[model samples]
Target: MFHKEGHKIIIITFLLVVAVALGAEYLIPIPWLQVCIQIPALILLILILQFFRNPKRHTPHNDDHIIAPVDGKVVVIEEVYEKEYFKDKRIQVSIFMSPVNVHVTRYPLGGEVVYSKYHPGKYLVAWHPKSSEDNERTTVVVKNKVWGEVLYKQIAGAMARRIVNYAKPGAQATQGADSGFIKFGSRVDLLLPLNTKIKVNLHQQVKGGIDVIAEK
Candidate 1:
């Protein structure tokens, strides 16, 4: 199924492609040139439709486990100092999303949102060492009964220009539920307790709301 967030853009693109194809058929006398123009336009619409597809996922409900927030490859798993809400050392797990991967972001666990903020910055590569802090991103913190506080940030990559967030402080978040969406490619960074057990390794492919990335 297609994502609701892309309905408007997808419809507009579909209409534009139809208009262009009809215009070329009637206005252009050369049949060969009309086929060339219409072919590329059709391909463009197909690619856009594929990018916004939202497959049905069963979100595992476990307070001790942390689900992956986006479909991508595990890029980094390291301990770093978190300066935003925690201001302490924490384990960070980063997933890098390509243009072909789903751009939807989901909650890692069920909890109450403690912090939600947006930061506008440069559009660096998703895997850059400083991209988590330097790139346009949104920080969200959820506090659960099993895990005190878990922080996740959605960072925009060079190709991703828009980041949509639905998290708000004091709101309840459901595990594996849609939290936001990023246009194009991007990365997601999760900051957990320093001793949290990580289940995935670097370069491992993960699916949003389906793959368990870590545990308490």
Candidate 2:
């Protein structure tokens, strides 16, 4: 199986260290320097193990009306002024992702992409209030028959910079289908209709491509 590049980072680091260890004997042939190299090599190996650890999966069994766009803890869930696209009051649910969380984004509902935009901004912390507005983000609006129109955004955080969005203005998107990917840490915001029922709460952990966030 092909591992995601994020998963392979640790493996590549380990191999590089091993190669350096073997090359030291031929190049330097110094006993004192070998001990120095060995100590740091052990430390790096431990860090690689931690970086490669898989987060617990939390996929929901059903997808009736809504699903999670990304995996992480819900940081904000309340009625707020959504100034980005609608410029009106809407229910905003924000999920904060740590470095360990899967950064891939999925469509929350099956529909045709109505609009899509990518913004360039600052790398604020994912949980910060300004992060959603100030951080680099990609906005996708999907038109669903049952849900009407829904908008979801992928925002980059301090450790994350690249936001990969695949859906175009007229693309077809299925519920739980891959829409894009964010590197490292980030956040996602789901802007829902005022009457849509929110199923998750603050600090509640949710899984991308699963974990329904709302329903008709």
Candidate 3:
């Protein structure tokens, strides 16, 4: 069976290698190379383990309404002016993905991709006020019959340098379907029409592709 959560194995392997390397250094300390080489190894191990430890909740069925696109704490939920594409009033829900959380991005609603674009920019902190505009990100607009046009952004944060988005214009995407994955820490911004009802609140912990973030 394919390990849906295979990151855990990578963490375990990292820890084991670090332990062995530390043991080897202590057992055979050389002249100037006597310094411990395990510090960096330990630090890397900690980071990798933390990333895999975050909750890996299952993505809900496609029939469900708007599910969350990333696992993280809901940081923003208010009417915001979306400038890049919509350039209009939208209810923006921002989820802050820590280094420990899953970096995958999922479709929030079922629809055909009407527009998709990638912006190359700086890697600001995910929550930085200008990160959404300044940071490297992918904007995807999906047109749905029930919800009209819904926009989702895959934003690359300081630690996350790569953002993988598979959505292409004219492609059909279903709610809760795996749309892409981000490496390391990041954030996801969902831009919905102001009239959409928010089902979650700021600071609420959410599971990507599982927890409903809003409804029509």
Give the candidate number with the greatest lDDT. Answer: 1
Best by TM-score: 1
Give candidate 1 regions above 4 Å deviation.
Answer: none
TM-scores of all candidate predictions against the true structure: 0.97, 0.80, 0.81
Please estimate how well model 3 matches the true structure, expressed as its whole-model Cα lDDT. Answer: 0.81
| Model 3 lowest lDDT segment of ten | 1-10
The residue ranges of model 2 lying beyond 4 angstroms of the native Cα positions read: 1-18, 21-64
Candidate 3: residue 173 lDDT (0-100): 92
* Local error of candidate 1 at residue 39 (angstroms): 1.5
Model 2 TM-score on a 0 to 1 scale? 0.80
Residue-by-residue lDDT tens digits, candidate 2, 92-188:
9998888766677888888899999999999988889988888899998988778778888999999886888988999998777778878778999
Clashing pairs in 2: none
Q: Backbone clashes per model, in order? A: 0, 0, 0
Cα deviation at 106, candidate 2, in Å, is 0.8
Ranking by lDDT: 1, 3, 2
What is residue 12's positional error in candidate 3, in angstroms? 14
